[model samples]
Target chain A: MKELSRRGLLGLGGALGAAALLSACGEASGSASSDSLSTPAKLRVWFMKDSVSDKAQAWLKQEFENKFQGSTLTIEQQEWDGIVPKLQTALASPESTPDIIELGNTQAPTFCAVGALADLSGMKEELGGANLTKSLVELGSFENKMYAAPFYAGSRIVFYRKDMFQKLGLAIPKTIDELTAVATKIQTGNPEKNAHFSGMFLPGISSQSAFAWVFSNGGRLAVQKDGKWEGGLSSPESQKAIAQLQQLWTTGSTTGTITDSTIGSQPYTAFNTGEAGMFFGFNFHLKKIKKELLDAGKVGYFNFPSPKGDAVGNPFAGGSNVAISNNSKARGLAKEALKLIFSKPFQEFFATEGGWVPGNLNYAAALGQDELSKVTIEAVRNSVGTPAAKNWALVESAKVVDDFFVAMGALKDPVGLAKTADAKMTEILNSK
Target chain B: MTVTSTRAKPEGTLPDRTEPAAPRKRRRNPLPYILLLPAVLIVLVDMGYPLLRQITMAFQHFSLEQQFGKPAEFVGLDNFTRVLGDSAFWLTLGRSLAFCLVCAALTMAIGIGGALLLTKLSRPVSVFVQAAMLLAWAMPVLSSLQVFQWIFDSRSGVVDWTLAGLGMQGMAGYNWFSNPLTFFAVAAILVIWMSVPLVVFMVYASVTQIDESMLEASTLDGANGWKQFREITVPTIAPVLLLVTILEIIWDLRVFTQIFILQKNGGITEQTNVLGTYVYQVGLSGGDYGVASATALIMLLITLLLTWRYVTQFLKQGEV
Candidate 1:
């Protein structure tokens, strides 16, 4: 038995040595001529699942293959929830990295700062020049060099049951306080008539929606003060906003425990059932409501109300940016693909099919003559975004804001929770 | 006596043994070693390299910069120190232990009961029961977890609706994943449901192999079923029980998918983290592979300590 075991160990050692030698040889060969794309190349593009329209994907695939002559572009769809880790590891490896990649506007800074994307500053004029989404441009640029170009933009709007509002004798709220009163009346009256009714389905886990309240009230989640980041949740403006949000949670909400993220992705799911009277969601969410609800003209969108009752409230802007991988072997082909992506025909698809505000405003003419589009454009114009800190994505990933709001929903001490959450946010945002 | 002598005769060993001519080279048999090569190579590559990498990562500052082709600095015990100093790591460790113990105990108790019941059933019934359990055991974890999520969904879920129909109005729209206790309860029930089948199969196979004559003798000695099971059946199948228990403990300690999946919707992140999910959060989400590796090593040591007794017993049995 001992002899057999010893022989097995010897065999294993031999096999491992051979495997290591083979891999070493492979690496040596790969580095021999690594600077340029070889013939018959395959360009791998990773686009998030719901970010881009299907027509755009099909067009890009056909166009890239047609134009490049010898290259193929494969668009791999990725999910947003856990993609940061996937991107970090994938983009770090030259062999594994995709040729073309899409970055969430919030996540672009991290990649750009790490030098994971090729420089796109030279394409500024060719892409869109000053017509790109300004916030996305800011996010995708590092040290005045653009690493990503704007792809599309979206912002949250209040989607209400217009029919229900008239039934309840409530007018569309014009101010934050009036909105609260409407929500309270609807919620209290909802349960008395319907078993599972909610005034506005503002789930506690939906921190981004809650941030609209904070931003409109002139509150920041975190701010760079004295060359260091300090969490702004404890600021009076933020506290007041959180208190209003807390009031909505206590008086206007139905389910306080489940996260809004779960509902956010499919906001129409609840509203379509006629159980939810109002919902805070992106403009495209209107297209996702049940057919019966749509046919009845029940869904109507409006910009969130300002704190002062004088203007549209600013929301947290959400969007995507496209960039080529720095380590891509087919960077030349990827650039050609990017050019195709930014062309007028393809860019207009963002507004025409995907129902998003085109990153290039020139194509936004295609979005003309629709109430949803009008409200969405107004919401997008009025929206503010997260601080341009490289580590804000980490804070979002850590769920600091999400937890704070969810805790607030449970009627926990808003002051105490905000203080604690602020300290955590400060630790993370400054950890950069 | 004549038959025994004939069977033991030297002539009997030589007859029909043309291979005996190569007896001198028999000790150098290459066939068995050749057969073992594939298995040994698989284990060496699949298990050995990753373990080595994990240990190396545990001792180094392997963060995003290192991940992106920069040189990884080797910092002796820094990762360990950070993990040891963090209160959250300790919380995760405690939660992991508590989850494992509870899940393992429940799995074993139900497993033993099912195995006992199978023994008393008729042959056809036993076959049908075993087949049903095998189906459950065969289902993939991902598919089963999704089904469980649907079953307990806050809205339109069957569990809530049924409970509400039973006059439990509070459960009508009860959000199960929101609460840490309820979330783990759902996870535990799913895990136990998936794990019991294997334990039942193992215990039943061993129980059927128990010496029937010994059981008969015990029965004749006026011992009851419970007493016989304790004194005779348990001792006879004690080795299998030890092995199954050790395996269950190890599996339970590394519970990941159920908790991770539920946490996606639960949003109770801080309160519900276990060791596996905590490591993932730190390594991937936090982008700190160094501390995650250190935590993983600590978990490995805990599992080793837990299974050490049974492992040594297993080795001793092999020796005997």
Candidate 2:
């Protein structure tokens, strides 16, 4: 037994030595030809999942290679949540930095303010400068200087279980109050046959999204007062909106608060299981839901009702923005790539293949006649981006976003809670 | 009483204790220490450095906003005081202890019982039982947890289906995680299932060392089965049992991935967070490293205090 133990120890020592030697050799080889590698004029591009989906990505990669010829463009796929930290780390070191990047339109103000992005003031004329969405272009600007070009943008639309609603004898709601009454009735009716079936899935974790309802009701999240920003959540208009949402929860929500930011498994599962009747999601959600409900003829899309009973306003626009990174070694090449991205061909590809409303509104009419495409195009036009702020990224990092939603979800008096949230937001905004 | 005659003439320091052995011309052989240097270096670099850095970070107002910069100040003991006073901290600590204790106790009971049963069985049967334990131990925790999550899924889980099949109307398809009792029950069952294999293996390994004659003598003396086990088996495996219990307690306290994944699936993060996941949420997600470090140090202190007695007892048993 002792001999076997000693042999085992010797064998372990040999294995460790071998591993160390192999690693050392690998490191040595990598460093040896480092200087011979053509000065590394490579363009690094980071994009989100569907910002450039498979077809667009393949076409763009091939096109960029053919155009740039001498320079290499490396594309990276990053999830929306991890982009902030990844950018922070990448920006800290010039070597690790990307050349061209995609930013959420809401996130652009902060990045531009911090000077983490390259100012696009010079590239204005080349990037369809005059034709971009005015609000979106303004969002990417700090001190009236553009830092990013408008990329993809889309708005939230109401998707419903059509068959379930029909079975419940519920007509489509045209106003906020009417929507609430219908949701309450459907929740009580439990038309889907599952006791757990809910009329809406307003997850507590998605406070920012839920705030869109308040905004669509002519309630702002914050307002600037004498050079000081004050939160608008405590306003009577916002409270009324929140109260309407809370009434739905009180009548019947899912067993717990569901956050739009997090769907532990898959968000579409709620619809797939016939548990949820309606969800306020972006245009891209149409692609994820359409196939699942197509066979049953169960799913249908509509715009969220406006408080004025006329039409939806400021419907929570979310999408990606294309920008040239300040830290890139291949800035020239990356600028060339951005040109290709904004071109009519690429923008049309975004609409036709990727199911996103291209940043260029002109391409909306070109998306072929399909139900999903038509609805997506309509959602894009009515969408509103988040309020632009210099410290918006910091606010997200402070993790108050989750807390604000959670408090709203659990509050007995949502009006009072919104007041508290406003106070918290002011503190956060003023801290900068 | 007689004064011994010192052969040397000098009174107080006679003969210099056999000439002091001449200081032995010491040869500084550093080979053994050099042989141990890698292990010591590994520990210092891998474990000690990170722990020291964590301690330093606990004293600062470190945040993601200034993640790359120097901390704002060295607010001595302020982070500790703030964390200690937080109500959420106390609640989380209570939950962690309850979870650990329950898991540890259950694992010990099942493990020791299985070991005892194996001892009474034939050789082949015992081997088969041990093989089953090996398979359980080999199964990945995440894989098993994923299976359990599906089985308990509120909508289409098999458990709810079976209940409904039996004509249990209201009870069928219940979301096990919605209620606190069922959440802890499912969590405890998963933890205990994953932990028992190790406890069983350790006890079984130690049990083989016990003499058969002791059990035989106890049986001949007309002791009952329970009495024989109490008199013979329990004492023999007491040290192994203690060791396994201490390990199980530590493992259960730090359980993160299972609960994190389960909460993600089950919609129970607020209700079901333990120390590991809570620290991760605060430090990484919340971007408050100072608070996380304080919380982590508190967890370390707690585990140390809880296991101090068992560790000392195990050491004493080793000496015996």
TM-score for each model: 0.90, 0.78
lDDT of 1 by residue, B1-320 (tens): 45335333444556545666545444355555566689778776765666577778889897665665567789999999999998888988899899999999999999999999999999999999999999999999989988998899888789999999999999987888878899899999999999999999999999999989998988899999999989998888887888788778877887788888888878878888988788777777776777878887787778778777876785566455
The per-model DockQ list reads 0.26, 0.11
For residues A1-432, could you state the per-residue lDDT of candidate 1 as single tens digits? 554453444333323322221121111011211335446579899999788888988998998798767878899999988888778767766678888999988888877776778899998899999999899999999999999999999899998887778777999999988888888888887733777788888877777788899999999988998879888899999989988987777788775555636575676777877778888898878678888878888777788999988999999888899998887877776888899999988998888888888889888878777888898899989888887777777777777887787787667888888898889888877763
Tell me the TM-score of model 1: 0.90
Q: Model 2, A1-432: lDDT tens per residue?
A: 333333333223222222221111110010111212234466778888667877787778888877756766778898876466556556534566677888888678767765666778888777776777777788888898898888877777778888878888988888877887777788888875786677776666666557667877777777778978787878888777777777767775663354324462245567667777887776566667757586778888877778877875557777777787665556656777888888888888877777677777677566678776676666667766556766566556544545555556654566665676677568656643
